[model samples]
Target chain A: MSDELYFKPLTELAALLDTKKISSVELTRSVIARTKAVDARVRAFNSYDEADALAQADESDRRRAAGKARGPLDGIPVGFKDVIAVAGQPLTASSKMLANFVSPYDATVTQKLKHAGAVVWGRLNLDEFAMGSSTENSAFRATCNPWDLARVPGGSSGGSAASLAAGEAIATLGSDTGGSIRQPAALCGVVGLKPTYGLVSRYGLIAFASSLDQIGPFTRTVEDAAVMLGGIAGHDPLDSTSYETKIPDYRGELKKRKGPWRLGIPKEYFGEGLDPEVGAAVENAIAFYRERGCEIKEVSLPHTDYGVGVYYIIATAECSSNLARYDGIRYGHRSKEARDIIDLYFKSRAEGFGAEVKRRIILGTYVLSSGYYDAFYLRAQKVRTLIRQDFLNAYREVDAILTPTSPTPAFKQGEKSDPLAMYLCDVYTIGVNLAGLPGISVPCGFSSGGLPIGLQLIGQPFQEAELLAIAHAYEQGHDWGERHPKL
Target chain B: MSAPADLNIDHVANLARIALTPEEKAKFARQLGEVLHHIEQLRKVDVTGVEPTAHAFPVYNVWGEDVARPGLAVEAALQNAPAQRDNMIVVPKVVE
Candidate 1:
C-alpha cells in the first residue's frame, strides 16, 4: 500500500486521507521513500529534508484528527521549483550564486499552499536561474526524462515535471517564462498550466524575466491542476503586478462550464519544424473536438515567426535588470579574490554565473546599451506589440487556440549544443508568454518511440477557467495520461 | 537597419560587471552575433504609430495605503549575507 501510494493523484489521496484510510505521514513517507529510491537515476531534486516533510505531515494529520481539516490540499505533499522561496529552505535557482543561500521568507504561493494545509516537500532542480531549455544548464545536475532516461526533460522546470511524472510528488509548482512549465510537462506526460500573467503573485519567485514570468502547477491530471491553481491563485499587495479579481472555485467551474466551443488552430504552429508524430496527435485532438460539435478553424497569426526573436530581447533585458541585485555584497556568493569594490562586483559575478548565464547577461547588456537601445530593445518591444496584437485579433474569432506544446518529443541529452538551436525548442510555446495569456499543456498522445507529446490550449487573458475546461473535455475521454513510465 | 559587426564583448561585459575569460569572450561574440542578426528582422516591422509595450498588461501608479507591517527580522535578513557586522552588510571600503 505504501509503495503504490506515491503515484496516486492528489484528489485520490485527499479522499483516502479524509476517510481515515491513510494518514498524511504514511503518504508523505511513501513519497519520500520513492524519491530516495528513484532520485539517483532521475536527479529531480536540489534538496529535500525528510524529517521536515514528516513533521509537516504529522501536523497536518493532527489538524484532520482534530476536525479542522483545511481543504482538499491538506496533508498533500507538493514539491516546488527551487526558484520559489520556501522559508528556511535552500533556494538555489540551480545556480552556484545562491547554492548556499536560504530563503528568509515564504513566497506568496508558499504561504498560500501552507494555508491550504500542504506539506511543502522539497526544492526541485531547474536550469540555472531558469535560463535554459534543458536542465543540463543546472550548476548541480541535469534532470533526466523519467520515460527515457537518455532523453532530456524539457526545462527550465524539468525537475518539477520529471518528479511529478516519476511519482515522487503528487503535484508540483513551477515558474514559466517561455514554455518552461509547459514544455517540460509535455515531455514528461503531465498537466502543466501557465495562468494569465499577473493572475498569480510573483512576489518571492526569483526573478527571471519580470514581464514574462508566471508561477503555475504540474499535475498528473487536469482536475488536480485546477485544485492546485485555486490554492495558489489570488492578488496580494506583496506583488503590485498581481491583478485583483474574483477568485472563482476553479474545480467547481470545471463541472459548471461545459463547452462545445470554437477552437482555432494557428497555422504557424503546425508548419515545418513540428515532428510528424506530435503533429498527428494534435490533429487527432482537434478532430476529437470537431466530432464533439465544437467548431475548429484555421486561424493565421502572421507575426508568429518573430516570437523567438522578440522574446530574446525583452526577456533578456528584463533578466539583466532583475539579476543585477546579486552583486556579492548583501547576500549570495561573494568572491574572495576581489581587491576593490568594483572588482568585487566583477570577480564575484564572473565566478558565480555559469556559461549560459554570462552569455545572456552580455547579450542583454548589449541590447539595452545607449547606442543600440532604440535599434534593438525598442524595436523588439514594438514587434512584441504586433505579436500580442496577432493573438488578441485571433481571439475575436475563436474561444481559444490549439497547438502542439512542443515541436518534438523530448530530444536526447546534449543534442542541442548550439545556443540558437536550443532557443528554437520554444517556438510553439513562446507566443503565449509574449501575449501574456493563459496556456495549458495536456498530454495528447505518445511518440512512436513511447515518448509523450502535449497539446497546448491558449485562452484569453484571465480566462484560465474556460481554458482548463476545454483541455479537460478531451483529457476526460483519453487514456493517454493514465499511462506511466516504467522506472 | 543594417546589422552591426560582431559584438564588442569587453565593453558589454564591463557594463554588466562580469569578467569573462578570453575563450568565453570569443565564443559569446560569435553566438550573440547570430542572435542579433536574427533580431535585425524586427527593424522591418513598420511602427509608424505603434506604441511599444513594456508590459503585456500595463498598470500605472499603484497606490498602497500607509500601513505598518512586520518585516523580516534582522537575523533572518542577514542569514545569507557573505559578510556582516552589527546588523549591517560588510562591503569593500569605498573610501581609503
Candidate 2:
C-alpha cells in the first residue's frame, strides 16, 4: 500500500491520471483493493460493483488520452450517498423499505458526474431514509469513525465521510438535511460543504426533509469540494426547487479574493456544554484569522437558542409529506401476509421503516395533522422565519460567521444512545440550513482526546465561492490537513 | 402534572402507530416527556406579529404555460412495484 496515494487530495489524483503517471483504471483497482482490505472493520459501504467502476475508469482514460478531457474530476473515484440514484443501480437508502429498489434512471447529479467522467465507486451507507445523527440507527450497520473504530463517524452522511477519511474514495457526495453532510465531515477530519439549498438539483435524490435537503461534497481539501460543486450545481427541469441562479467559478474565487473579512462569533454558540479543548481550538482558529487582518466581533443570533426546536418541527413535517409515497403499493417492500390493501399499507410501512424513522414520521404526522397544525406546525413555521431573519441581519454586519461545528469533538460510539442527545450534535449546523445559506466545515485543530475539531464558516446565500476561498486560505495557513488518522 | 401513565403513552402511541409493548410504551413516554420539555423552552420568547416564513428568500412563483409534456408510461412506473398484478398495484384485502 502506497501511503502517498492513500489520502492524496483530489487534484493530485486528477494530475496523476492526466499525465499518464497513473491510470484511472489502476487507481480504481487500488481503491477497490483498499476497500476490501478495510471494509469488514469500517463497514462504510453497503454495496460495491468493481467491474462497473473499472469500466468507467477505462472510459475516463480513453477520453483523457484523446485530449477530450471531460472536466476537472475526469478520472477521480467518488461515492454517492445511498439516497441518490444511479441508473441501473439499487438505491436502498439503507432501509428494508427500498432494499430491492433499483432506479430506472440516473439522478440529475449522477448524470452530471458521469458527464464529468468520474467513476461511481459504490453506494455509501446512510441513516435509514436519511434520519438520525449517528449512523448507528442505520438498518444495515453503523459506520465506524476512521480515527477510532469504537467512535461513530457523524451521520446521516456517515459512510460518505468515513470513506473519504479512510481512503476508500477521494471524494463522496452527501445530502444535508439538518447536519448530515457537515457533521460527519467535522467528525471525520475532512472538509464538507452544504451549498445553498437550491444550488444543486435534487431531481432523483430519495426524499427526506425536502425543503431543507441539499447535495454537496465531502473531500480532503476545499479546492476539491469546489471542483465537485462546479459539476453538480445546476438547475434541472425535473426538480422545480432547483435554483435558476448562476454557477460561479468557485475555484477561481480562491485566487481572485482577498479578505479583511468581518467574522461573527455568537455568544450563544459558546454556552456551558462546549468541551474545553473544543473551545480552545475555535478560539485559536479565530485568533489565526484575526492575525491575518480579519475583524472578529461578537454578534448575537438571539434566535440561535431556538434552532433545534424549529428544526425538528420543520424537518419532520417535510419528511412526513415526502415519505407518503412508500405505502407498499408503488415500489420496494411489500408485507408478505397482508389481509387487504389497507392492511398492506399499514403492515408494509410498519415493518419497512426503522425506529428513528418511524419516530420522525409520527411526530411529523402529528404536527401536520388537522388539530395540532395551528399550534405546533404553524408556530414552528413562523419561528423558522425569525431564524432566517436573524442570519440575514447578522450577515449584513459580518462577512461570514465563525463557530465550532459541533459542541464537542467526536464522542465514543454509543455514548449518546438517547435520541435527543444524538440530535444535539447538529445544533450548530441546522441553523445554516434553515437560513438557506452556504456553510463549510474545515479541520481546525485537535481535541484533548486527539480527535479533530472543525470550525464552521457560513456565508450569505449564493456566496459559496467566497466561503470556499476563506476555507482554502485557512487550510493553507494551518497544519491541520497534514494530520490523518492511521488506518 | 403527572397524569395516569397509561393514558399519556396511549395518547401518543395511538397517534404514532407503533405497537409498543407495555414496557416500551412506558419508556417512550418518559423519553418523549424529556424531549418535549426541552422544546417547551421556546415558548418563553415573545414572537408577537412575526410572520411565518417557509422559504429563506422570496422566490418568484413559478407557474408554467399550460402545456402537457411526456408523462411516465404506466408500465414503466409500475415495473418496480413489489405486488403489482394486472394494471393496478395488488395488495391484501382490508376489512371495514
Candidate 3:
C-alpha cells in the first residue's frame, strides 16, 4: 500500500486528500518511507528532514480537518532543487564552495510555495552551481535515472526530475539556464515547464547566468505544472529582472482551451545528431495534433545553428560576474592556508570550485577580459539578438513551435565524458532560452531500450497559459504522461 | 579575435582567480579550444548595425517605493559567514 502510494499523479492524490480518503500525514509518511527506501540507488536528494516534513504534513491535515485549508497545494509534497534559498536551510547548489552555507531568508519561489501551503520538503541535488547538462558535476552524488539506474536523469535539475518520476515528491521545482529543466524532464519522462524569463521572480534563486536562469516546475502532468506555475509566478519588487505582468489562471485556461491550434516543427531540429527512434515518436505526436484539427506547419528558425555558440558566451560571461560574489569575504568557504588577501581570494576560489565550474569561470573571464570582450562577448550578444529574432519571426506564422526536447533519450552515466559532446545534448532546447520565451517538455513517447522522449512546445513571452493548454491538449490525447518509470 | 587554439588557459585562470595545475591547464586549453571552435560558427553571420541583446526581455529602469522595511536580522545575516567577529565578517587584511 505504501509503495502503491508513491506513483499516483498529483491530481488524484489531491482529490484523495480533499475527500478525506487519506490524511496528509499518512501521505507524507508514505512518501518519506519510500524516499528512504529507494534513495540508496536513486540519490535524488542531498538532504531532507523527516521531522520537519511530517510536522508540516500534520499541520496541513489539521487545517483541512478544520475546513481552513489554504489552497490546491495545501498538503502536497514539493521538492526543491538545492540552489533555491529556504531560510535556515542549506543552499549549496551542490558545490563544496557552499557545502556548509545556510540561507538567511527564503527565495521568492520558496516564499510563494509556503504561501500556497505546500509541505516544502528538502534539498534536491543538482549540477554544481547548476552549470552542467548532467548532474554528475554535483560534488555530492549523481541522481540516477529512475527508468534505468545505470543512466543519468538529465540535469542540472536531474534530482528534481528523478524525484517526481520516482514518486519521492508529488512535484518539484528546478531552474533552467540552458536546457536544464526541460532536458531532464524529457529524460525522466515527466512534465517540465520553463516560464518566460521575467514571468517568474528570481529573487532567491542562486544566480547561474542571471540573464538565462529562470525557475520552473517538474511534475507528473501538464495540469499540475499549470497549477503550480500560477502559484509561484508573480511580480515581486525584490527581483529586478522579474516582469511586472498580471498573473493568468493557467489551469483554468487549460480547461477552456479550444481547437485549431497551430504548431511549427523547425527543420533544423530534426537534422544530424537526432536519434531515429526519438524522431519517429515526435512524428506520431505531430500526426495526433493534425488529427485534432491543428495545423502542422514546417517553419524555419534560421539562426538555430548559432544558438549554442551565442548561449555559451552570454551565459558564461554573466555567470563570471555573478559568481564573483562568493570570494570568501561575507560568507562561504575561505582557504585555510592563505598568507594574505590575494592568496586568500585565489586559493579559496581555486580550492572551492569543481572542475566544470572553474572551466566556465575561466572561459567567462577570458571572454569578458579587455581585448577579447568585443570579439567574443559582444559578438555573442549580437548573435543572441539574431536568435531571438528568429523565434519572433517564426512566431508570426505559428501559435507554438514543436520539436524533440532532446536529440535523444537519456544515455548511460558516463557516455558523455567529453564536455563538448555533453553540451551538444541541449542542441534542440537552448534557443528558447536565448529568446527568453516559455517552453515545456511533455512526455510524448519512449525510445527503444525503453527510455522516454520529450516533445517541446514553445510559446510567445507571457503566454505560458496558452502554452500549458497546448501541452495539456496533446497530453490528454495520449497515455504518455500517465506512464511512470518503474523503480 | 585570435585563433581558437590560442585561447590561453593560464591567462584565463589568472583572470578568474583560480590556480590551475599544469595538467588542468593543458586539458582546458584543449577542451576550451573545441568549445571555442564550436562558437566560431557565429563569425559567418553578419551582425553589422545590429544591436546586441543583453537580455531576452527588455527592462526599463525598475523602481520601488522609497520606504524602509524590515530586512534579514544581523544574526541571520551573519549565520552563514565562515568567519565572523562581532557581527562582522572577517577577511584577510588588505591595508598596511
Candidate 4:
C-alpha cells in the first residue's frame, strides 16, 4: 500500500489523511522512495532533500493530529521547478551559473503551499533559464519522456511534468513562459495548467520573460490540477503585476460550472507541421465535445502564423533584460580571469551561460539594440497586440478555444538540433501567453507508437474554472490520464 | 530597413557583454540570420495605429505604502555571492 501511495491523487490522499488511514510521513516516504528508485532514469529532479521532506511531513502529521489540517494540500508532496525559489534549497534553474546558488527566500507560491501544510519536496530540473521547448537545453541532463525513454520530454518544465507522470510527486509546480507547462504535460501524459497571466505571483521566480512567464501546476488529473491551482492562485503585493482579483474556489467551481461550453477549434492549429497522430487525437477530442452537446465552431486567428516570430522577439528581449542581473560581482558564477570590470562581465557571462542562453541573449540584445529597436522589438510588440486581439475576437463567439498542446508528440532526443526547428515546437501554445489567457492540457489520447497526446483548452482571461470544468468533462470519459507510463 | 543578413554578431555580443569565440560568432551569425529571415514576415502585417502591449494585463500606478519592510538578513543576502567581505559583495577595482 505504501509502495503505490505516491500514485494516488491529492484528493484521495487528502481523504486518507483526514480519515487517519495514512500518515503524511507514510505518503511522503513513498514518494521519496519512488523518486530515488526511478529519477536515475527519468532525470527529473535537480536536487531533493529527503530528510527535509520527512521533517515537513512530520509537522503536517502533527497539525492533523491537533485537528488543524489546513486543506487538501496538507501533507501532500509537491515538487517545484528549480526556477521558483524555495528558501535554503538549491535553485539551479538547471544552469551552471547558479549551480551552487541557494534561494534566500521562499517564492510567494512556496509560502502559500507551506501555509496549506504541503510538504515542499524537491527542486525539479528544467531548460537553463526556461528558454527551450525540449529539456535538451538543460545544462545538466535531458529529462527523458517516460513513455519512451529515448524520446525527449517537451520542456522547460520537463522535469515538473515528468516527475508527476513518473509518480515521484503527488503534484508539482511549473512555470510556463510559452508552452513550458502544457507542452511537457502533453508529452508526459499529465494534466498541466498555465493560469491567466498575473493570477499567480512572480516575486521569487527566476525571471525569464517577465511579460509572459506564469507559474502553474502539473498533476495526474484535471481535478488535481484544480486543487493545485487553488493552493497557489492569489495576488501578492510582492509581485506588482499580480492582479488583485478574487481567486474563486477553483475545485468547487469545477462541479458548479458544468458547462455545455461553446468550444472553438482554431483551424490554423491543425495545419502543416502537425503530426498526423497528434492531429487525430485532438480531432477525436473535438468530436468528444461535439457529441457531448457542446457547440464547436471553426475559428480563424489570422495572426497565428506570426505567433512564433513575435514570441521569439518579445520573449528574448524580456529575457535579455531580466537575465542581466546575473553579473559575476553578485551571486552566481564569476570568472576567475578578468583584467577589468567590463572584461569580468563579458568573461563571466560567456563562461557561465550555456549555448542556447547565449544565442537568445544575443538575439534579444540585437533586437532591442539602438538601430533595430523600432523594426524588431517595437514591431514585435505591435504585432503582439494583434495576436492578442485575435483571441479576444474568437472569445466573443466561443467560451474556450480547443487546440493541440504541441504540434507533435515528444520527439527523440537530439532530433531537432536546429534552433529554428526547435522554436517551432511552441507555435501552437505561444498564442495563449501572448494573450494572457488560462490554458490547460489534458491527455486526450495516445499515439499508435504509444506517445501521449494532449488536448489544450484556451479559456478567457481569469476563467480557469470554466476551462478546468470543460477539460474535466472530456477527461471524465477518457482513461488516457489514468494509464501511466510503464516505467 | 536593414536586411536580416546584415546582423553584426560582434556588435550585438559586445552589447550583451558576452565574449563569443570566433567559431560561435560565425555559427550564431548564420543561425540568427535564418531566424531573422523567418521573423521578417511581421513586417508584412499592417500596424498603422496599433498600440504595443508590454504586458498582457497592464496594471498601472501600482503604489504600495511607503512603509519600510524587513528584507533578507545581511548573512542571508550574501549567502550566494561569489566573493564577499563584511556582508558586502566584493568586486574588482573600478577606480583607475
Q: Candidate 3 — which residues are off by over 4 angstroms?
A: A1-3, B1-5
Q: DockQ scores for all the models shown? A: 0.82, 0.47, 0.82, 0.87
- Tens digit of per-residue lDDT, candidate 3, span A462-481: 99988998999998888877
**Model 2 TM-score, 2 decimals:** 0.95
Give candidate 4 regions above 4 Å deviation: A1-3, B1-3
Residue-level lDDT of model 4, residues B1-96, one tens digit each, is 233555889889998999999999888888888889899899999999999999999999998989999988999999999999977888999998
> Residue A245 in candidate 1 has what lDDT?
81
What's the TM for model 1?
A: 0.98
lDDT of 1 by residue, B42-90 (tens): 7777877888988888777888879988899999989999999999999
DockQ: the better of candidates 3 and 4: 4
Clashes of 1: 0
For every candidate, what share of the true interface contacts is present? 0.83, 0.46, 0.87, 0.89
> A-chain TM-score per prediction?
0.99, 0.98, 0.98, 0.99
Chain B fold agreement for model 1, TM-score: 0.89
User: What is the C-alpha lDDT profile of model 4 across A77-108, one tens digit per residue?
Assistant: 99999999999999998998999999999999
lDDT of 2 by residue, A159-226 (tens): 99999888899899999999899888988899999999888999999999888899999999999999
Query: lDDT score, residue A477, model 3?
Result: 85
lDDT of 1 by residue, A84-197 (tens): 999999999999999999999999999999999999999999999999887989999999999999998989999999999998999999999999999999999999999999
Look at candidate 4 and tell me the lDDT of residue B53. 91
For candidate 2 chain A, the 10 contiguous residues with the lowest summed lDDT are: A1-10
TM-score of each: 0.98, 0.95, 0.98, 0.98
Model 3: per-residue Cα lDDT at residue A404: 95
In model 1, where do residues sit more than 4 Å from their true spots?
A1-3, B1-6
